[model samples]
Target chain A: MKPRVLAGLLTLALVPAAAGAASLGLGVYGGMSSPILNDTAGNGPQYGVRAPVTLAPMLIVEPFYAQSALGDVDQSFGGSSYTRSGPDVKMFGANAVFSFGEGVKFYPLVGIGSTKITQSGWADITDTSLNFGLGFGFRPMAKLCVDVRGELNAVVTGDTSRKFGNLTAGVSYALFGSE
Target chain B: MKNLRLILPSLLLTGLMASGCWLISGQFTVSQDLPTPLDVDSQIVIVGAHIDLNTQSTYRDHKNDLKDLADCALLGTFTNTGTGTLDILVYMTPAGSPLHSTKVQLDADATKIKVWGPLTLGPGASKKVGWDESAGLFNADGKQALLKEVKGDGDFALYAVGASAPYKLRLTDGVAVVVVDAGK
Candidate 1:
């Protein structure tokens, strides 16, 4: 589906949860993303915001949007080499999280998202893919938590597909929860 | 819940394997416009041309010297600045001969010995072409001949005739002599 339509659906899904839910956490995260494909994109910094809403004691749904900074790619044609630099990438997705334990929590996450990569010289590439992640969270206080996660994003564009890995750290604050 | 635990880990493991060191493929297409042609008064010119000599040398301990063998190649670019499509023909003929001095009008059906191209360049577009010496020489009738039997070093001139009416341009820069020695 188109990214804008997916975004609208996500927003609509979040509004009622934010209004009536007993548990909701808002988070901001930053991390390093390494392109794992062979000579496709470069490693760069990514930052994003997420909102997690608890549905059951061990289940949560998180919707997030992340943007990665410019990266470089080298291209060669007919014995000549050219450097294609500064492609900015953006990702939007929703994840289902299954948490275990309290105070210290471990979660396994599965998601689906769309990635848009844009550069100056070449045409824009946009595609959707699946996401997988493993995360750990530490709750020091009733309303504060620290989280670290490693995520893998798989996207395909034009006859080539690549998987990128992101390692991120962040803090979340419970705005409205059963504190 | 126990079954869910087993299923999630299995799915995650599958995702990891799929995203890792494996090759994935897809395809897309992009298009761009052709370059515009130059004015009618402008001509097609030989921007740059060069002959490159690639040599390999090895040390001979018995002879106390190095022996080298070289291969010759011609590389150049031609630009058409005229309003019409440029048709070009390149020739390597003996320098300072009547054939070299002779001016032939650009004709669609003209034939010549050792012709390089009937290359067509759109207006304002530039084309680069290269030829290697080992590729064998050809006569006007496209018969193969040995390079040594043709003409020797510096004995030949490389010239091109570009026709893009109402202009016919003849271009020849001084012959380029470049030697690249790969000696070990």
Candidate 2:
């Protein structure tokens, strides 16, 4: 994971010479995440922060951290009588973005992260997987912005599997004083 | 339209992922409503003892009957109003000891026994927890020892937590006689 983060930073660092421009920005945002579907355990709000470094006008890389509940996997079929708790899971990942200019930006981002879920009466469930984000952001103001993103996370457990997705809108404050 | 295109694929993938996984077993439902106790004039004998499991009956048929003559089974019933889930456990204190102990997940209610032993319930939607119907005795030692002293008109501090109301069965000369004398 450290290697991946270094590679992303290196790409952002060297992009100005090759891609004609560079822009570095830091932002903070909070929003809700819903575990819709067979999501029986957790369906609540999620909050996080992202630091996006732009390389040229079309390219950007963001490293982020979020605290959220990704919902529970039903353990009743495994002969256990207890309900598994969708413990608070922490995620760390980086995304690559492609902006189409104006207030609209469309990007296909990929990252690797892990989520740890604890059960009510048993051991915790730790999952590592790849997560993807494909969506567009709206910069309604130059320094203040509104972004809508769709995320898909595929989590792999020892005995079972689970997935989570969220379509969220956020209000972000740019620390670089530029959008 | 743009948002729809992005979210639709993931939604479809999540459906596939949810369908591929297995859910762990054991369904539990808890109810706070108290079940009415079964009223019987017959002597309700209580007996239980914490005897060594090595001496316990394993034949499936006699597992509920007193083994090594140690425990007592508390017997009573609740009139069925509707069907739901129940949790059951047994409480015991050694002879002349004030501290009481219980087996882990040792409670029984309407459907099943949580004990590591066989899931035993007689022929109906409901089953008796402590008494062995076939052998006419308490299910095991732990139950026998608890009721050994209930052989006469005496009130002993007992503990029982079930889906039914926490109850204390009154012991009469008739009710106490059901418990066989297990000398402490």
Candidate 3:
């Protein structure tokens, strides 16, 4: 993980404040994620934090930082063992979250950003990415909310891409300074 | 000699220039398509006509001189030349060694180092393949056992096994990029 990247993503979250956005929700999410093709890194847990700033009653721009540890890719033939450990991943992005309904909201999200993947003794890879997902948000109190989301994140380079799925649950609290 | 050409320059290659280290690279092409049996298991060997190691002067002269071998890699593509689909299992072996069949559920042979594929190719489709460090595990590359065999012997072969010979398929490719060395 690069400190500069983390700093950059954190900076994007504060952008909504200058616009005097209606509500700002700061939250943490954790869940299971696995790749869909050429699964080099097996399934594992992923966790992240997000700062979602509402621009309108139905729309929010969410900036997030997420990371995941990876499992080794192993194969054996004849007797020699070939082990390719992750290119483990870290991603930072912003999504446009569109909400539907009242207290219990349904949102479908789409976002784009960059990803960094590294493996021991090998070169690290950096690429562009896009994530698409749907989320259900529940509010038990006026300023506190709980949400569950299912997302497909794709890291693309040239004509090739690696895709993974993440399903996560999160809690957020709305701070003061909303319209 | 149909089409195997060593791509490395002979200038830097000597048994003792970097003292016993020869960085060799080459490509072999089979200009025609090979047909595979479709109803039962059948095998094809890429040998003398395609991978002519015998005629290449520098390659022939220095192969036996390599004392310690480095992890090498092969990179290329194979095409499905026929209209029907091709399901192929690829392996590298000491030339003409046979023992795999769609007939057997298991093959206990360790000499056959699988380098590529359960590769299925559609009609007129081409897919690239590569193998280097993982070529022969008979004694592992850096350990020097397989290096002795890879360097000393000629007629090293590439094998392809087809499962279920019901309807055959044709394959063609210029298997490009073979690199072998000593030390790292």
Candidate 4:
């Protein structure tokens, strides 16, 4: 692990476990994602615990780690029996989510995070990307809420690269926060 | 051969430089949809599969095939098929010929399939695949070095399906153990 990444993860992990005024949540998320390589669609399963440290009523910082599969993509030639399978892509990231709204009914959110993606079968062929996410959540109770999210991850590799996106919906159990 | 030697050393260096560690855990279940067989004591099924090695060079050179390939389980028997029994084949199938099968057994639980060896169950019985690892892959030390040496490109799939339903009895339950070396 790089020094910066280590520092980032440590900082996020130690996010003042005291749920003071902020909202802490943990959940598992899974859904379909359009991979950057070759595939019609693939399943991505992610499990993470998120804690929001609110700088203000509308701004919160959330850090997360997730393992996802890009699925087996077909890259083999048309007539060749020798077909190739794509490796699974595992990722981890931390984001700053900006929520907008007042009443505890509904709120819209947008955020950005730095992501580290690892490709199986291809060791060291890793990608560190800047991802932007847009989503919303509704909290009907004091400790429970549901959120739907989508993110566009742009990975930079010296010269040419691509943008990948994933959309998922999940329910969260809050340790503390306003209803 | 000279170029191959040079490339091999460079690849080794690259692998060393990129070495880190990983912890992976997940659950996989195979639900078979086949007709049940009638009048049978028990039945067994085998499932074999290989993990994918994603790379263009490996795919072209067939390096992925060099790694040792083996399935932990042998065969599982489903015996409680009272009126009739349904036998179905389940496993990740390879793309090309010479299909591989990972044999599994019916665990004592009767609901889950214990993939270690042969298992016996009565008629009308279904089983799910389950495995547990406490420490995980990271505990394997530098064994990841072995992963680098494995370079053949292959995808997982159900290669063969030979099950006996209650109405039609086709094949009987059996066990087969084979060790596959990459060089072979």
Candidate 3 C-alpha lDDT tens digits along A80-118? 334445457898877767779977899988765678877
Best by TM-score: 1
Question: Pairing residues by index, what is the TM-score of model 4?
Answer: 0.42
Q: What is the alpha-carbon interface RMSD for each candidate?
A: 15.6, 18.1, 19.8, 18.3
DockQ of each: 0.09, 0.04, 0.01, 0.02
TM-score of every model versus the real structure: 0.52, 0.42, 0.48, 0.42
- Give the per-residue lDDT digits (tens) of candidate 2, residues A1-179: 44345434544554552233244566665655554323234565677777676644656556666777545433221122223344465665555565665757776766545565443322345655446777677777776667878886655443233456666666665555354
Count steric clashes of candidate 1. 7
What ranges in model 3 sit over 4 Å off? Answer: A1-18, A79-82, A177-179, B1-184
What value does the lDDT take at residue A140 in candidate 2? Answer: 73
User: Candidate 4 lDDT (Cα, whole model)?
Assistant: 0.38
Task: Identify the runs in model 4 with alpha carbons over 4 angstroms from their true place.
Answer: A1-21, A37-47, A76-78, A102-121, B1-184
Candidate number of the best lDDT = 3
lDDT tens string, model 1, B50-145?
221111121111112111111122234456656678776555443322233233322222333454556677777765443322112223232221
Predicted candidate 4 versus true structure: per-residue lDDT over B1-184, tens digit per residue: 2353344335434533353210011111111222222122223443333334332342334342343321111222233334444434332332422333222332221222212212223345544222111001112211232223233234322222324433212222322111122221
Compose the digit string of candidate 4's lDDT tens values, residues A1-179.
55347437644554653345355656556655555432222445444455555444555555565555655432222121111233354455555555676543333333323444443322233555445667777776667767788875544332223346677776667655642
Instruction: Please report, in order, the local distance difference test score of every candidate based on alpha carbons.
Output: 0.52, 0.41, 0.53, 0.38
